[model samples]
Target: MASRQMQAAQIVEFNKPYQLSQVPVPQCGDHDLLVQVYAAGFCHSDLQVLRGQFGAALPLIPSHEPAGKIAQVGTQVKGSWKVGDRIGVLNFKNACGQCVGCRQRLRRTKRTDPRFCRKRQTAGFKHDGAFGQFMLADPNTTVHLPEKVSFEQGAPLMCAGATVWGALQKLKPDVKPGEAVAIIGIGGLGQLGIQFAKAMGYRTVAIDNRHEGRRLAVDVSEILKPDLVIDSSAPDASDQILDFTAGEGLAGAVVCTDSIEANAWSLQQLGNGGVMVPVGLPQDRWQFDSEAMVFRELTIRGVYVASMGEVEEMLKVVAHHDISSHITTVDFDQIPSIVERYADKSMKGRLVVQITQ
Candidate 1:
């Protein structure tokens, strides 16, 4: 039997550090699974949540990216899911299947995608999330972790990897194989984006203004590394990208950074009718030249995390390509320091909190 109480790192107040406390284990609903969290990822969104940007309820646990084993299975959940099964959970929970977003998703994909459901309570925002020993997860948005993927890697894939994968999927119809694709940021998400793009057979180019980011891109394994790493701050960076693409510019650009300047600058590097997907959530409003957009026929598509089916596909791709997340694992109690590191943007890659064996 699971313990009634578990250790958790919680935000007792807004714009304050997390407080470690013993909280009741979240009850598993009829349509939910009780997960014994093994690893939880720290995301940029977590920082926003700490700052109260997401209007998260106080005294809430704070990590949305969690990978774990099923401690108990709900009777209402009819599937292969059983206790002891390894899984990774998406942030959205208890999606109302009758809503317009859900119906539209069903109509188009013939799959009940909960990602677009407005009635869903986002983990770490409206509801208690990971950073605890256990959490309740909806089966609709949960995915089985691959044998080759560890909990540390799976944690970040729940958000960072899935977000980029979904963004690249948006460009599939328009961008052809061997076409140029630029991934801006070169951070955790950007690193995974580069691998996904490469695995998809796109000529991937990594762009970053920071020296550390540029170095990280270059340091990736030969098979997964981008075809070219460009300094986005360079005066001739756009020209360099254009030249690489035979003066046609990039076929697709995925903006993984939250910098508004990087977002606007990415538009200039796209070819005619090229698509740009913004995966970052910046507080500031994004501005663009209307004439340039109209003349170039540039496209901007905003994407959230991947649908459940897409997330499964992403895991398969990760397994097949041996894709991995560069992570720094910390003990659960070090959650406060992790927040500080993230706030200052001092971390190299994803940060994961080891919760259990």
Candidate 2:
């Protein structure tokens, strides 16, 4: 048989562009699926990996947010999944089923644990990812897409959507619906956070910088319809939040920016007994007011991506609420230039690579 070949954008060196070239198609393993890529979402983390920020392996095919149809499945794959099933790949490629985390999750809930995996790694960074015509997928890290969600919409949900979804989920067992919640940063993750907050019945505040140009918060407010939009570029951003909340500060805040400056402001905006969740990966060191935290009894926590069960639930919410990532889809071949542009001046919305139709 002739060797199967596919087009892939690969990073051969650190801080270099992805080389779009023909490579041998990866074969499906015992628990793997050969996914025919439809779309792949690019993110800031991709930039981090490309610049060796996370010490990512070189010659990587970068893009974890991929949605597509299954072209082939391995024999050991056991489930309702089948060839031609529309699905999205999870960022956590595979977790060891024998770990303590995995056992605990399996016993207590349907969630899958990405940590404590014997061989845990992100798909796009460690393994060949979705910037290609085809990629091998671990059936364990893949989820079925709902009929209402398009491949493009499902792509970024694999990571960005799941990250924020999991963060918002942290807001309660204690926090009640209709409590004022703020989403900081107003970028891709924050945009989705706005929609999720509203759908979850929180009085959502969309926070970001005042624009010299088109304002993301304003543009998104028209779509997701956040209850309030505050430009934090101005010094009165926290004041605006307090005024809106009637002298009490935010019940919860999700800080989506990587800037320590943004994180500090978000922490200050939290009300008494409020929780502040930081999702951004900042490069610099950060400090918080120990006195304020002690006096106010504020909680600062962090959230990674969602568990598999949470991803399913988030997809349902998204589909039902008609929520979507504001994505700019480009041809797969343009991955190199776009990635460079992203590092210098990031795009407003999620940038996606369309591999197939």
Candidate 3:
């Protein structure tokens, strides 16, 4: 039998901060895996959840990206996974299996069940999440961790890495090799976006409005050997782009910034017929003029979270690609403490917390 209580972070109410509490451990269903969460990544989304942006499923355990060993499994589960397997938990836990979204996504992906499958329980968002010593995950969405990657390295991919990877795949039909691709916001997601875009053989451009963000963008560019890294924050920014692309504009722009202004400018900066993909979430409205859409014929796309199809592909990339997210690791007890800090936007990088450590 499982322990009656475990360490968890509770979001007692919206607008107020989270409080660390010892809560009853959740039980697994027939198809669930009682996972011993060794590592879990804290995301900006988690910060949003804390700020009551997503609103409380009250007392949320806010870690989505997690890597851990399987402690127990319920009946009806059968696959490559077995007891003690090390795997990465994905962000979207379950899509409503009966919905059109799930039907379409299920038809498109390898997993039998959709990760957005709302009918079942989720690790972080819906039910109890990964901010505890043990988390219940659907084995269908779990990606086996490679020996080369630590629990921390695998953590971010459970969400950020997969999100960017899936967006790129959707943009694949339009993105040609050797084309110029720009990414806004050099934060955690943007960092992985740069690497993924570079790996796809696109000439990458990393853009940021801040000093450290620019430096981080440049650092990724240098390592990934992107064609250029532009500071949109710098003076003469558009002029710099005009020279770089020679009035042709960028071949494509992945607007990881999610800000209306940043995304709008990036969309306007795209070349004729260029693809503008938005991966970040914004609190305000998305303002885009019809001219940019109709006149330039730019393709604007927004991706929330990746479907199950992207999980395996992303894991294979993580296993082979020299991809690693810059992260700050924390212990499970600090979930509420750190979540409050993130809500204010003062913290930095991918956050990976170990529940069992």
Candidate 4:
């Protein structure tokens, strides 16, 4: 049973360090689980939220990429889950199951009462997050973790893995299973994007601006076995990409960096009839030529958080393909310091914050 209060990393204000404090461990009375967090992924999204980029809740305990065992479940909760059940928490806390969008999609097989529909609350942002030793998860936003998946790998799957995989699943850019798909900015999301794209039977061309990242891409390629690696740091990267694409250009590209400049280039590199899905967030507005978009039918679009169904499909792909996460684990207390460093693009792969694992 959860005690009244517990350890949590809550931010007091903008630009201030996250403060570690003992706060009440909330109950799962609202058909939610009191998850004893085992491993929570430290995501770039966490950094974005911490810096107020997401602009949802403040003075908050911030962490969305969470996986853990069920510590407790509400009495009225209706599911096969019990205490000790392992599950993953997604970035979206709740979407109204009664709204036309929700009812048509997630609510089809789920609890359909609009009153139970959570139009409000986002864990780790509007609501509290899994940065704590214990966090709350509603039935709608939780994903069951497969037995074969480890806490470290499962941890990153909650966000980095799911975010990219979910994007690919939703966008479904028309590159055939064996055709090439270019990825920009080989970082946490980019790395996962490469893996998912490769696993989906798409040849991957990982593009990065730094020698360090290019070298890392080589290492990742050996592990993940992506088809092509291009050093975008070189001036001839676009030309090299053209050569690699047989002078045609990529079938599609998923812009995975938090930069408008990089995305603008991806827009250009994507020749006739190509789609570029922008999964990364940038502070500046994206600019592109309307003529280019119309003439070539170039697609530049954005993707947000994953749906519950999409999260399950992502997990299935992870299991069927056995895509592992190269993760670094840290104790719960290290989250603030680690998150700060992560904001500067210092941490690697996905950071799994140890809650119990």
- Highest lDDT scorer: 1
In candidate 4, what are the lDDT values of residues 1-357, reduced to their tens digit? Answer: 666887888877766777889988876785778898877777777777777876865668888778889998888677787888889987665555556655755546654422234585767766688888888777767889999887778878777776777667654746678777887877777777887888788878989886655555555535566677887767898998888878888878888787878878888888788888888777778877788799898877666656677778888887877777667788877866885566554555667788774
Position 112, candidate 4: lDDT: 47
> What TM-score would each prediction reach against the true structure?
0.97, 0.94, 0.91, 0.90
Location of the lowest summed lDDT over 10 successive residues in candidate 4: 109-118
- List model 3 lDDT by residue over 1-357, tens digit each: 766888777667776656778888778788878888888887877767766675447767766778889888888788767889888887555555787666765688633455545465555665567777888887667778888888888888888888887777767788798887887788888888888888888878878887666666655435574566778867788777767887788878777776888988888788788888888778888888789889888898867666555677777776677778877887766665775555455455677887776
Superposed Cα RMSD, model 4: 3.0
What residue pairs are clashing in model 4? 177-201
Better-scoring candidate (lDDT), 1 or 3: 1
- In order of listing, the candidates' clash counts read 0, 0, 10, 1
Candidate 2 per-residue C-alpha lDDT over 1-357 given as tens digits, one digit per residue, 9 for 90 to 100: 987998999888888888898888888888889999999999988887788876766678888999999999999998888999999998776777777877777777665576446567678877788998898887877899998999998999999999999999998775679999998888778888888998899998988773511266555535567888878877787789989999899999998888898888888998899998899987777778898799999998877778788899999999888888777888977888977655444467688889997
lDDT of 1 by residue, 35-150 (tens): 99999999889888888988866888989999999999988998899999999999987868899988998899887666788788899876888999999999888999998899
**Ten-residue segment with the worst summed lDDT in candidate 1?**
338-347
Candidate 1 Cα errors over 4 Å, as ranges: 1-3
Candidate 3 Cα errors over 4 Å, as ranges: 1-3, 106-122, 220-225, 340-347
Deviation in Å, model 4, residue 40 alpha carbon:
1.3
> What is the TM-score (0 to 1) of candidate 4?
0.90
Better of 1 and 3 by TM-score: 1
